[model samples]
Target: MTGATRTTEHSAADDDVSRRLLESSATLSYDPMTEIDWEAPLPEDGYGLNPEWSTLYGTPLWDEMTEAQRVTLTRHEVCSIMSTGIWFEMILQQMILRDQYVHNPANAEFQFALTEIADECRHSIMFARTCAKLDVPAYFPRKDVVEAARIFKSVAGGEVAYGGTLVAEEVLDVMQRDWMRGENVLDIVRTSSKIHVVEESRHMKFARQEIREHMEGISPLRRRASAALIALGASVIVRSLVNYGVYRAAGLDTRRAVEAAANNPHRRSMMRTACAGLMEFLDEAGLLTRPAVAIYRRVHMI
Candidate 1:
């Protein structure tokens, strides 16, 4: 097809995706402030997440941990993940806001992009409150990683920006699916995960559509390079999800806990399984190149 024809088709597809997503959000988006009981009494026996989802769940270290220690560790871990989610949501909000600058405001694409930014703002606030309610201080990514992402979020655009957004959403989506359903999990976590899962489903779809639009006419060389860049972003996100401070906060030896979590086969399996659908989507979008796959393998995301 002609270049003009392809551009027209892309616009049509983008419009259709954005319109449907807007409709979905209007029908079912959440306001966590009113939804969660901020003052509810905490169940002393509830866990922050499913035990199976814990990084050190199957390790010998986990076996040695007292039940109380296990509970503390998981609380710190989930709060750490929420903190990371806040960081990433803020980053993507900036990227999307930047990308939409001076665009045709009448288009559904522009409107949905703004809507996503609004949603992410709310999501970040929700995460922050959850951490506060749990009495867990926010765990930030390493200083250098934060500095690096500062540069990336400011400069990233097009497929690379949308691709990174999709990777983060997809990674979190699979785990939150489990968290939302874990019967023994904390009510706070379960309800928040439910809200996140429902809303982020639309964000993931919007991102996939955005990435497809960006990829439509780019050259193969640029496509491969974009794949590698997005993979690198994914590596940063995976590494930052669980901060080392969490172990210290949980009263475990930071080094030992980190080592155990790093080597846990069960955790690796969980990551790989969580990423399978994401990997398929990336592969179909031609963003899962050899170099990208290699990067994902290093993080056990493949």
Candidate 2:
């Protein structure tokens, strides 16, 4: 055989191995319908929220709604955003998992990502159905440039980006679940939230470990690039909720909601707070290093 032919065959073999790794690790099982007790009663303890939830009350925009409207808004706010966020994230994950199969199919990481893709699908369906049960319509806008960038960056950054995201988000999940410890206002939400928290804990831990491993090998410039991309992805994920039905029911315009949310000082402060907490969490997880920290700080995210 010619040398060129041999090299081509060798490359093909390596590709085959990577593909196999991904496929092998991709199998996972979870039944959304059977996983949570949907009939659970809603807890009454302060509406199952952290005291900081009062921040919503402090906002002039939130005050525009009537008391009954406030109740509807709150319920809609939590379930709708959670549902939408899960839906978008899962869709992105599924795409990424498919790409993994195509690009490096046989790798264990690819396989594991495949399993996660399945989990994300289940989660998206579960959340959508839950929203339907709560009388909220589920809708996702057509993909736009910003959304596309987020999906791309998230997939590119892989486990580390996923982990950093979880660091900011998981604590919110924990806080939400904790609200259910005593009261169950929105029983379905409480139960589903519980299931989510339990499942996401594993994803978060794995992402953190992967990020720590990668950070060691990445140069300072690469780390900054990673941070910026991840942060941009995070920003898009954060901004995608402008079209939620709850905003409509509150007699609010979606565009205005987006604008208000973007320029809101209080929200900015909350963002800083969440990012800071995420940094602390990453540090505790052994991922906070000079380069990573520098990137985060330079971006003014932490």
Candidate 3:
């Protein structure tokens, strides 16, 4: 077969796959009230979550926190981490609406997009309400809004190009879900977790399949894009994990918290544990090309 014919054949194959995905899934809804469970009681002990998470913060930072600070972080930062998942989800929903459904009003993807938008709104509200219950300010600056938009824009390539992002978001979700499951979370938080767990599970599955399919045809330049994105993802993941309050209260330099957290072998290992499985999956899917692995090593290691 000629090169041109091969390229044509590949395009047709990809188009077929995309169509199959859209056709196979049932239509989704935008209704949040009907979808989530709002009455479950919070867990009694969130410490026995994934042992890595317990070990990561259970030592120096957990011990250093004041009762008030502990209450505040538990109420706010703990949930904030989960809420960050919603935050990024909502951003992607908007970006999808902006780019994907702009012309197609009844696009099937729009339904999933709307569901995420509602999910995120409720998650943030519940998080703030829980913070108020503990008298912790649930304020995230508007600048973070800008930052989120910037990152989303930069990463808004096709499903394959943005695969690392999907992996990162879901892993963070696991961390929070496990944490909440271990502790005696507030009623609101417990309820929020029910919604998050269900929705994120579906989202993660969708993203996983989509990413795997998208990675089928990779090129060297796009592979480099994947590499850069994975590196940025590591930075984003670490920064997201490094709580500013944790550093300030621990009497460690807040300025170097990310460096310190990344430098900590245990913490780094924990992060790698969270991400490495997905890394291997991507590698098998041909998503983690040579360039991407090199970039991953550089950012993940000192």
Best by lDDT: 1
Q: lDDT at 228 for candidate 2?
A: 56
lDDT of 1 at 35: 96
Alpha carbon deviation, residue 128, candidate 3 (Å): 3.9
| Better candidate by lDDT, 1 or 3 | 1
Q: What is the lDDT of residue 90 in candidate 3?
A: 56
Which 10 residues in a row give candidate 2 its minimum summed lDDT?
Answer: 1-10
TM-score of 1: 0.96
Q: For residues 267-292, write the lDDT of model 1, one tens digit per residue.
A: 99999999999999999999999999
TM-score for each model: 0.96, 0.67, 0.67
| Model 1: colliding residue pairs | none
Q: Output the better candidate (2/3) by lDDT.
A: 2
Q: How many steric overlaps does candidate 1 have? A: 0
Q: Candidate 2 regions off by >4 Å?
A: 1-31, 35-55, 95-114, 139-147, 150-155, 158-175, 182-184, 242-245, 252-273, 281-301
Q: How would you encode candidate 3's per-residue C-alpha lDDT over 105-170 as one tens digit per residue?
A: 354443544554555566556555554444443333246644865766544655432464466565
